[model samples]
Target: MSLDFAKLPKAVASRLAKLGIRQPFDLVLHLPLRYEDETHLYTIADAPMGVPVMVEGTVEHADITFRPRRQLVARISDGSSELFVRLLHFYPNQQQQLAEGKRVRLLGEIRRGFFGEEMVHPKVRSVGSETPLAEALTPIYPTVNGLAQPPLRKLVNQALNHCVLDDTLPEVLRHDLGLMPFDAAVRLLHQPTPDTAQRALSERTHAAWLRLKFDELLAQQLSMRLAYRRRREQTAPSLRATGLLAQQLLASLPFGLTGAQTKVLAEIRHDLASTHPMQRLLQGDVGAGKTIVAALAALDAIEAGHQAALMAPTEILAEQHYKKLSQWLAPLGIEVVWLAGSLKPAAKAAAIARVESGEAWLAVGTHALFQESVSFARLGLAIVDEQHRFGVHQRLALRGKGGSPHQLMMSATPIPRTLAMSFYADLDVSVIDELPPGRTPIKTRLVNDARREEMVEQVRKVCSEGRQVYWVCPLIEESEALELQTAIDTHVALSESLPEYRVGLVHGRLKPAEKAEVMAAFARNEVQVLVATTVIEVGVDVPNATLMVIEHAERMGLAQLHQLRGRVGRGALESSCILLYSAPLGEVAKQRLKVIFETTDGFLIAREDLRIRGPGEFLGARQSGVPMLRFADLERDTVLLEQARDVAGTLLDHHPAVVEAHLDRWLSGREELLKA
Candidate 1:
């Protein structure tokens, strides 16, 4: 049952809800982060160093002083041994509580200081004449600001007492798998006995942790499998793949398809001819030629007497697809309508009308296609480019435009295998692993910013060879916080330093017309250098551009850096990308640089990215309104994931009541996320 929010104080209720505790049972299930061994006490001198311990003593002295900095200092003695306690930050009441001759208990890490053993800002509690030590290891939970441990601990204790602790799974299954019941796992996690090993709890190799991880994974897998089953029940148009127009487009292409592309195209054709809607993810490295495959798939929808819409994340990429597809489709007399937010009112209206009245068989634009004003005559296919940029709702909204149109979502960022299996389990995925012929591999180099002058000379050398260069800056404008080089400033500096060649600039803040003009000049080699932000990260393909210099490469992510590097090496000529990084680089940034410099394989880079940064960055907009796993690590708990995936099917097939109970205990209020 849902907790009565009105009965709680406004702030308390808000904080509890933020922690996903809308019901009393939620508090019962909210496990501890770590346990403090408050069950035993230590003398000040005998307390272990570098680990937390509980100690009781009488205050000998207390004062606020500033030798180097202002702080509160106190000396406490347990009759035989005395230790110093310092608080860098403290309240007046806390100073009073540490007054001389008062008995107190402290819990914190102890370390050897200049004078003696010391604890910095330890948890302090004034003792009456006598108080009993804690009976069990104290649990320290995950909490937000303004919520203290005392009240939260009280609520959780009450929940443990009053909330029902029934097992969601049957006794037979629990015994067969050797898994602990859900209630026992939650309880043990919250209140472990003092004898419990800290190493087992900290490392989460305990049986209780395993059970929780298995249950979490099982719930997630069940939700995805059920969603998959329900989706198949919905009806969608079965567009027959006659391969008439697809063959025509393939013949007109200047280059033939790679083996990977041919294989993926066949998969798309099979899905398109299905009665249910196709929710497929087509991903490849930046230069893997996904646009051409999607273009041919659009032709299949058209050949089946239905229209198609291609949507992108940015106007630059959208316009690039529009121009390229229009160029290819124009020979066959296919009308392609261009619609974007930047279009003039009359132009936008005309484009929408043509699409609505079936005058155009293809429509390409940014997110404007998801707008209410844009209606399709018969949107058999809705191909979204940069699927990571659009949220789950936006993609669903676009697909719902023409009564569940078949979707082919495309991404330049490849998804790691484990991530695709767990996070993207609901969707069908197609991968293009091969780069087309004549595409040369880019040599990547990591350079320190101290060598900026050498890079300037390097840029001039590439330009002198009659090839273009791209200078990428992390920021578009000046900011007091980061103080990194901005695109605007870099554009001016490059133009002045290399006066023999023209340098053009483009950024998100620029008008569409102005940005297009600069890109056009750079594409034609009229402008020898293009200075821009990540807006040029994708779809600005200048085969003549042989060099790319990225400033503050440490500030960008692995996917963004890889995409930026892909702009070059599109031509037969050898290309190189130099990543200029600032010193004092963070550990994560260093790992990203090392991975990118070591390997040109996108899949390997994606795997490394997943390891360095968990699944959040890679999941992208698809994480919206989704119930993410809290206990299971996709990489570390592969055994649990495999077992859960297997059990989810069996439970749904034979144990419907158990399935409902498991989902209720785990998902509860967020069941709709599964359907999404």
Candidate 2:
């Protein structure tokens, strides 16, 4: 038998297409979400509470009533006890179907209701007393709107019976790894025995699920390994780290490098000295001194007579890097050039000319660094800060500007262990885990909006003690205009309330000069209170600022909250961050607030964030550029990931035939252009 999705009904084909299922293989991989138990019937009293179960009883009566709102209410009796059925919205025929003396089957959760024991909006149908129960549990698959479950199940069944599912992993290998055969795993997952543990299946921890996840992870690892091998095959300049420039700058700094920073810099230096372009991800928690490490990396490239460039996601962050790097490198007689969208034409022209002439040893800017007009004379290294905020193509474009420059991607947002293992498997990752000494941990507090006045008073008190404060407004949904308005309103409110202190406003709408002025004043302690938007979430540093009051903290993610909190604790005056949230928080918002309030560990917060939000949203722009895992849960399938990673290397080396077939089946067209 053969399955042709294109020849199927247009509606069915269109719905399947909506789910990225274009072929028989896709349908086969589209597995069940959960199973509905219909093989056994439970009486009203015997049916478990808060779980789906099959129940059959005779309808004693059915009527439409207005207990407060109009609804169809019915009572079902199993000869001993009764259960109420409420349908807030129902058709007239549904009432007739459930009229008195009718025997019907109900499949839904049972719980105590407003009136009595009830199952609201359950699957309802009339049935004869002699009707037999199902022989197996019904498989409920994931579907989109306008596609019903019955049709989806029929499509999956067709695909399963007709689609050819060959085992990609060798039988000997599967046995060695304690994995089930591919066909058996698929069949068991689609049609499990009644004795199978529901919890294991639901949580994807069953043996059958293990095979699927392992295969998926193995495909991803194989793809990444191929990418890594391809990069190694290409040639790049070996920027030997003579340390002539790097050492001189390190000694010039007033502060000493942390041990973690030293270790990461050594790893990067080793990579830069290699023949192949270094594709490494540098992850450090906020304020871990990544800038200095990046500076040193750039210095190595310059010392080896190769130019380097650094790209940031925002102008503010780019300027911050330009200033810091200039302060460090200018004294060493290595000139630095700044290129940005905000630069005047003559200034931008001069920067471009310097970069083109190789007079500027290192260039720093926002996305403008990758613009076609900006050219690099001998680009050897490219560093991207806040790498996640930019899409995969943007990073690729930057890398393309150089003749295969050694790329260093930096992120202050800590990547969780599972993510680093799975998504970033191809790159050599270096982490700066420890902070420098004398920095006090920021105390995180969750306060309600009603206490806004008290927080105002707290800000007043903190500033009166000769420290500064940052009061941030929530991100607006539709309107940048509205977001700017909110910032302006907050700035006005703070200034009026605290008349004795100098309050300054800065937002994305502000001119660069104005924004820089406000920031410099705050750093100088002239502006006691700074009100701004999330623009400051990345690059602002004020040691004197000891208090941070974020409005509507529930509206932000764990990473943003962590970054915002980091802005305050840079000083040693016992900093604190107050997260002010409004009422009626959603489940995700509550979780974000709780995670931010309880722990300051970025890695722990990242793990919780991944759990709260899945990998697609968590990976941000990388989702479009990488083949993401759809079936595997990173947090739960770490062991399988480890096994697959080992197997990927094995298959690539010994079973090359098996590698082609496996990659063809899983990642055929989904391979990302993940150059960086």
Candidate 3:
């Protein structure tokens, strides 16, 4: 039976919608935040202080008093002792409801008041013959405005009563895994005995919870596995590396490829040579030489009589890639085209024409490359940098520009192995786990904001030494709401503080041309100090720039802090990252700064970030179209994820019907998006 939300009261429907509850299953899935032992009641005399208790008593006196600040006061007795109930704010109707001789039930914590033991603002209701009470532990669910606990509890109970579920896991699998049946697990979770509820809520390790979490994870894994299977079934162009162009490009590079890069590139080359399209994730720490591997892949595609397109998250990064690729490939007579959203119509048309005619061997652009007007003669490879910035649909849209083009996604923010195994199960993974040789490890330190003058003087000292420096701020402009320093303000302040130094400013609000100009000045050594926002976190490359000062660094995420620090240490000179945080740091922020100060390993930072913020916020799931995990916590439930993956793979291979049913049940309409 479908529990139609439309049939509910208007206020109820709106409140439920606000809580993201629309379907019967959604209501059932909305588990209790906590459970209260309302089944047992205690008399006023016997009730312990400082503990929440439920009590039934007869009201002896109730009135509104004005002397002590307009409060409502009531006295109640349970035949043994009297208790005081005080409400700092109450309506006249509540006073009448608790009038003399009326029986009432209340739940609240008992505390020593001015007069005697009292329950301030206790939940109060009239006791009548028709009043129903829970015989077991009462569930307390999360609620929004206009939706109280009683009504929400009732609605959830209604949903549970009407819910009809069919077990999707095979009996043999359940027995072998020692798992409880699905229906039993659901019932146990929603309505458990007092003891079970206490254990489950307190520890969050009950067998019922384990059963439900595993099922949810299994659904996600099955969806991604199915997507992988379907993709493998499709045919793709085999782009083999003839070694002529790749060897030429490798020889031109002044430095040798790291062992990790070589190994990952070999994996990519093998995938490209296969008939199946490549859905690969190339992950590495910041400055781990992923771009070279990407370039090699592009060269392989170009040598195979096909064009390659590399799309970055931002125009600056795209331009960076375009410049680097051109410098590497122009010597070999390979033409590279640039496409961006900010390009003039004429320029864009010319670039598109080059791509269409196959005159452009490699196309480097932002999201503009995936536009409908931009087409290629033989687009065989598609490379997406910072893959987290784009959704799965955008990837598909770009792939549509070619006939199952080999896809290679690169992320500087190293994903934890567990996350890659479960969340990215659909894509084959190749990790460049090593940094290039001779790249100095960035020395990081936490500088308190009280030493702002000292830090400014230090920047000047670094600039006086002929090295460039970067001052990164979290905000672009000052906000009256937040007192955090802005990039513009910092630029102005530094310009005044160091009048002799050339300081340039760049932020996301600037026009593309303006940003490029400012960055160009910094690159050419014309600007000694460049103040910018986090826009430079990914793409800016300057060999002479060796110092970075991040103001209010505690306000930034660990992944972002790591990325910003990566901007430095790219050159031969030793680099230092100073995290200028305010005096009072939150515990999490303190830990984040400590992590950044301790290690330059991006993978460790990612794991710590995941542990601190959980998976959704770490990957930016809301913006990136990463499926929101409702039941499973990636940090705590990693074992469940692994077990679910194993079970999903086996079921898909052996019991496809059961796997499909399970996916349909848990994921419902989200199976397609979960493929990412």
Candidate 4:
């Protein structure tokens, strides 16, 4: 029978709905955040001090007091000892419930009050002759503002009592995996026996967490694998990599491709030559020549008499790709068109026409490229840069433009192996593990605010040597809310401190045209020192800008700091990155700075980033169409992920019916994400 939220009380249902609990199954899966041991009740005098304890007593006196502030005080006695109950905020119902001679149960940490031992804002419930108390550890769930723990816990217990969940995993597989049964795992997770180790259950060290984590991991893997199978079933144009355009573009380049780049390009070539659609994720560190590899891949599609589109998240990045690709392909007799949201009507229309008429073999633009008005004549490949910034639906939309054209996604933010296995399981991944030759390594150092004069002198000297500098501020403008330095204030300070050099400012708040103008001036060396935010992190590639001073660098993440540092060291000159931090650096901030100063490897930094800031913060909540993982910790449960992948493959090969059952049980409503 289907469960209904309407059957619940009106107020209770509203609060539960806010917590995303609409059905009984939702309640069944609503696990407790923690467990409080409220099994043993003691008199107020016998309760353990400074420890969470349960006490039972009868109210002797209750009234409102105003010595320090508005307060409600209730003196309760257990016939042998007296205790005080303090309530800062109380309802009239609670006041009546705590009237004289009324028995009550209280749970909170015991502390020595001014009068004696007491509990401030303790959880209270009026006891009656028929009321039965729970004798086990009480489960504490995440609750809404208007909801309390008692009702929520009772609802979950009620759901559990009526739930008849079937075991989803195959019998043999479950036995081999040594996993607990589905119902048993849920029951134990919610209500362990009094003898169960409180520490183990509360810290998720018990075997139950492993079983649930495996279950969740297996479901995710099966979904992604099924999605991969479905995508391959869809036919796509098999564009041969003839190397006509790719070879020409390579020959025009000043340097040779690194071995890693060559290997990844060969893989892409193999994928393109196949009849099946190519869904590959190309991961490269900053300055590892990912764009060049993408450009080469696009050229193969163009040479095969098909159009190719490269989409970026921002217009600046789109324009950067446009300029670079145009320079490489225009000389080889290939038409390159740029389409952006800010383009003039005439220019956009012409660009659209060229794309539709197959006059332009290569098109580079932002999200505007995927608009309904724009259509490709015969698109063979679609390249998306900074793939994480774009959603899975956006990728599907872009690929739909060409009837499932070969999709190649490039990301400068290198994903750790755990994330790659779980999140990018659907797509084939290729890592460019090598940087091009002659790319200088950036020297990273941390400087405190007291060394401001020394850092300023360093910037002035770098600018005097005919090179530029980047002074990055964390915030755009001065705000009373945050103490971080702002670009506006920094620009003014830098311009005044170094009057001989040109200082230009750029931030996200600037108009596109204005921002583009400032970036262009910086690129042209008109601005010797560009004071900006992270707007220049991904796109701006100025060889003359060799020095970068990031103020309040500790405020940024490891991945972002690495990207900003990558802005320098593109040229042959030795580059330096000074991280100006505030005084009294925190442990995490100090570790971040040390990691950047120690190693320049993007993959190492990415792994460290994942370790420091879990998967949720590292990969955003809406990274893809797939639902955010709630049970499995990607950092700790990678072994489970690997096992799940193997089990999923086996099930698909040998036990297809069970696979469907597993997916239906765990991911019934999320089937569309796999297809996406």
Clashes of 3: 0
Top TM-score prediction, candidate number: 1
Residue 142's lDDT in candidate 2: 83
Model 2 vs. true fold: TM: 0.89
lDDT per residue for candidate 2 within 104-148, as digits (tens), equals 999999999887889999999799989988766788888999999
Q: Candidate 3, residues 306-418: lDDT per residue as tens digits?
A: 89999999988999999999999999999999999999999999999999999999999999988889889999999999998887787778988997989999999898977
Over 1-676, each residue of candidate 4 has an lDDT whose tens digit, in order, gives 4445677789988889888777787787788898877677887777888888888889999999987888889999887788899998999998998898899999998888876778899989888755776767788888899898888877888888776777888778899988889988888888877788878786666788888888888888898998899988988888896798788888888888999999999999999988889999999998999999998998888877788999999888899999999999899999999999999899999999999999999999999999999999999999999878887778778888988899998899999999899888898999999899889989989889789989999999999999999999888877887688789988898899999999999998888789889989999999999998888789679988999999998888999999999999998999999999997889999889889889999999999998898777777557677766778888778788899989999998888988898787677677786665
Which segments of candidate 2 are over 4 A away from where they belong? 8-14, 42-50, 55-67, 73-85, 92-104, 110-118, 126-133, 344-350, 438-450, 476-486, 509-514, 571-574, 581-600, 611-614, 621-624
- What is candidate 1's lDDT per residue for 1-676, written digit by digit as tens? 3345468898998999889888787887688888888899998778888888889999999988987789998999997688889998998899899988889999999888865889899989898767988888899988888889888998898888777778888899889889988788888888898887778888888889999999988888878888888889988889897798888988998898999999999999998899898888998998899999999999999999899999998999999999999999999889998999999999999999999999999999988998999889899999999877877777778887899789898988889888777777778999999899899999999999999889989999999999999999988889989989999999988899999999999899999999999999898899999999999998988999999999999998898899999999999999999999999999999999999999999999888888887877666733545677777888898888888888889999999899998888788857666554
Cα displacement (angstroms), candidate 3, residue 63, comes to: 3.2
My TM-score estimates for the predictions, one after another, are: 0.97, 0.89, 0.95, 0.96
Better of 1 and 2 by TM-score: 1
Please state the error at residue 445 of candidate 1 in Å: 0.8
Clashes of 4: 0
| TM-score, cand. 1 vs. native | 0.97
Of 3 and 4, the candidate ahead on TM-score is 4
True-structure RMSD for candidate 1: 1.8
lDDT score at residue 216, model 1, on the 0-100 scale? 85
Candidate 3: list runs displaced more than 4 Å: 5-18, 66-68, 129-132
Q: Which pairs in model 3 have colliding backbones?
A: none
